[model samples]
Target chain A: MIRRPANLRRFGLGLLVAMPAALVVWWFLAAPLLVPGMAPAFAWLLQLIWPQWGPAVEVNGNAWLVVTTLPLLEQPLQSAAIPLGPRRFTAAFALFWGLVLATPGDLPLRRRLRQLLAGSVLGILPLVLLMALLAFHFQLAVVINHQPALTVTPPSVHVLALPYPGWQFHLIGVGRQLGVLVLPTLGPVLMWAVLNRRFIRAMIFTGLLSRLPAAAGELDHRDGRA
Target chain B: MSRGLLIGLTVVVLAGCDAAPQDLRRALAMLHNDQGAAAFTQLQDLAATGYAPAQFRLGMLYLQGEVNAERRTLAERWLMRAAAQGDVGARYYRALLWLSRRRDADAVDAGAQALERLAADGFRPATLRLAQAYEAGDGVQPDVAQALSWYEQAAAQGERRAIERLATAYQNGELGLERDAALAQRWRRQLAREPFSLSD
Candidate 1:
């Protein structure tokens, strides 16, 4: 009954074929460079924030950096173990979004590849920005939460209510709760929606969108934008 | 004669097991009772057999320099033997011994290397010592960043000296660090939370 079941089926097949290959490329090539590359950038940002708060920074393997931050008494301690959680953009998500943006209709293989490559860059740029912001927020949160525990002598105050700036707390709250948890999967879907708004509208109304109440007509406007 | 022979055989069997345990127990008991010479005698027998605890105790007695004139030499011998057997106290004391020689470069290096290994394993005192060495350039190159790193590590392990040092460093911009009063106050606030003990 669907007008473009073949296209959907073809996209699924293409996804199955391309996913593993993409993962292999990301793991072997992209990850090694990308993960460690975050360290100096993170350190620089921290230094800019607090000129005197430089700690020993080093990359641990290729997946993350274990940063020893702050001195207690006069010794070093691990303040944060920052990991580059690449699951969001590395394998399944990348392939699924690529297929959605590339071969949404009955496009030829060359055209599909061109669309896929272009859409991937556009989709990944937002993700990369989100990751960098999250890293900064995450480190700030860690220090705020753990600062009191790194004590030498008896503390006069029992607890510190707000360790970081007021804005930092809000930033961390949003970054951790929304950006880190929700955005990875949602980002690709949203990106795909932007790329192929028409196809999404046609598919949705024909399938589940038709079953929804009259209030769902708002989505029709979105579909028309494509 | 046969009954007497049997009694003698039983006594011999009882004595066959190492008497080091009993000697150690007696030594501790004698020391507890304030009988220092008796304890020393008991410790000597067990220490001669290369018992680590006895050796460490004997080394401490000599290191105290209260019992004899050749205390340093005797302390070195016993502490070295105990250290070879991986006694923590012995290792710490031996490192301290080397560190105390302010003018001896070789001694400082030896102490620094030993403490560095311990520091890497998250030993608080060793971490603090290593940080100081880096800060002062006693046995190693003067690297304020490295000192800060070590101080941070020690602070993480709840070392009071390291924590205070960090707060001071941030406050005064010592150790090649920039002055940050906010961080200094933050650490100062932490110092108020619980009682810090040197023994910790």
Candidate 2:
């Protein structure tokens, strides 16, 4: 039991030490490899919406995915931004590294590997959902915001119909914000907590009750003269 | 092993290898593995040899900001070479680079010509660029008629921006087109029919 806690602490320390290196690898190396896979997944998600129609994703060697739609009219307008970029994937990769490093060390290497893999899979599910939401937001943003570079005569017509509903944009904005700011950090922490619940419980018990002399004295009050 | 000896021996062996294709593959592998600087070194000789793909790849690496200022100039040179060889990607990016850089009118004209060729090949983005060029006279003479025609072509190809522009122009009598609310409404109806899809 003592060794287990020490091992857990050691694992936590290992994560602290390894995090910067992990982030570097995630940004420089892992993101590029993941882009090819991520592009297709983003396309597949888009395909789910348009049925047979979907944007095509091209992977640049620098690890960016350029999403192109088939001619919306006479020509294809490339989407304003990459559907998923290094910034998006790097966060999740950092989370994976955290999970791998901080997972309970008493578990066998294979078991730990399985846990890491499972945690990564779970983390990616929500990320993919976020990507789809961002893609929709981006497509709308490009369509509405992009104007041809030439001056056309002023139109008297009022644009009564917004292409996308108002609520959807709000929702996408919130989801994207969360994806960038919260999910990357929180997702892995939650996974780590869940996977190592027993260790956590033990740590809690050891930290609060068993390790406290004051609590032990309180327990012995019945036999005291006072 | 002495460092100089090791370097000399490796250079001699690499010189004898003479397999540009394999070197290119190795460069690609290095890039995929996130060794962009190394990939650039590998690509240099092949690009100098006038290989179209290597030139294109070098241009991309330069665009990626993987290389310094000197290399950035090399990127334009390589991209121009690739474009001359009729590489579609090279043509597209070189056009974009010229536009983004907002180079002189002559450069803009060159970019427009590249775009026009691609547009002739039925590429929608090129068609859109050609329309913009005609409308703004950015590189070509401003011709509302040419612009509208290009817009119509793009809209026929299902370009969303073109559709929106055409609808607005028809409604407002912009771009020298006569105001026709009926035609505008028809395009609006088409826009409505092509709904944006997202899963909840």
Candidate 3:
């Protein structure tokens, strides 16, 4: 079935390449929406504008996740921070999709198709990370605003409870909050292992593709040579 | 090599690739793991070389009554050193220590003068203390005008206590207030509605 992991590897390379671009998009897109005279506080501006992201986070060797308000009530949620926001997604999508559609015109069919999908998926990273960061900022906003009692309630919400051990919720809230804030720039890191696997596979694919004939060179060339 | 050994070695290599990050992480871990004493020792080593955070930390540790030995003088010294480095935390403590010392009203004009300097430097605690001195005629003659001004400056810095004082002062026409009901009502509303803002 084209090997699911092989499919994922290509996805990660595309994402890594797109991360910086996404950062630029996030800054440019969200900067205008910020309150006047608030120059250059990327995290604060992002959090203020799209507070749904919660707050930025840092964890596990600078790894991160930028959570947005898709509101899954998820457990063991990812968290991170970086320069990220909503606008980057639109810009990355357009860039990746544009490259993908542009390739089919001149490149070989299989190569062109795969490149398109890889580009599209990879392009989504910047936007995905941005959305995640914005969401995290908002989550932090809520926490700062609510100062929610750090009590584990039915596993739905993890509060950072004090003086009481055995509570996963508090750790989750603190970790995830940190994870999401740092996730935008760092979220792509999650894709590294996946990307490494893909790169090896892609190299294998390249080896095989180059070794194999290009559709057997239409076969008629052999007859003509004879 | 056997596959398992190879895999283990590869994992070890990947894990050890970031030694610096690991060390920094370990240091941060000490900070969070309630090894404050150990952290303080390392921080003090850094502080001896004039690290701003370390100085600020030492100052705060002294001013704040932790289980550690009470070293008020050392606290002020470290706090001053860090404050001179423009560390906000150190500056905060500098204001605190300066304000903490109580003096008989007219006997120590120099202490009050020093407080005025801290107050002008955007230290909310100092501003409030100076205001109190004016309000109570503690160090100088009770000058309602100076008290009101100092209170306003402190209020602007989000000191809730000062905001409350200013609100009350304006409301009661105390501290040389001319009984301007309009201004008093405005300040009070600003406090109630915008707990942080300086104006209505």
| Candidate that scores best on lDDT | 2
Write down the lDDT of every candidate, Cα atoms only: 0.60, 0.62, 0.49
Tens digits of per-residue lDDT, candidate 1, B108-182, equal 778877888766644566777788978988657788988999999878765667889999999999988899999
DockQ values per model: 0.03, 0.02, 0.01
What docking grade does candidate 2 earn?
incorrect
Best by TM-score: 3
True contacts kept of each: 0.06, 0.00, 0.00
Docking class of 3: incorrect
Per-residue lDDT of candidate 3, residues B1-200 (tens digit) = 69999999777555424232223233334765888677667656656877655566556555544533358778878878976876544554465455445553332555566567655654445677788878887646688788888888877754556767766766777767666677777777765654221121
Query: What are the runs in model 3 whose C-alpha is more than 4 Å off?
Result: A1-226, B1-36, B66-70, B102-126, B136-142, B156-161, B192-200
Q: What TM-score does model 3 achieve against the real structure?
A: 0.44
Give the per-residue lDDT digits (tens) of candidate 2, residues A95-207: 66765666554788888878767766676555644654454544433343221111211121111111233455456556655665677667667767787787778777766
Clashes of 2: 14
lDDT of 1 by residue, A1-226 (tens): 2244444566567667666666677667766765565555444444445332232235667444423222232211112223445334344345444446444476677765665666666565546545555654554444433322222122221111123444765566667656555666677667667767777776666555445643366578778887
**For this target, which candidate reaches the highest DockQ against the unseen true structure?**
1
Interface RMSD of each: 21.5, 17.1, 16.6
Candidate 3's interface RMSD, please?
16.6
Whichever of 1 and 2 has more TM-score, that candidate is 2
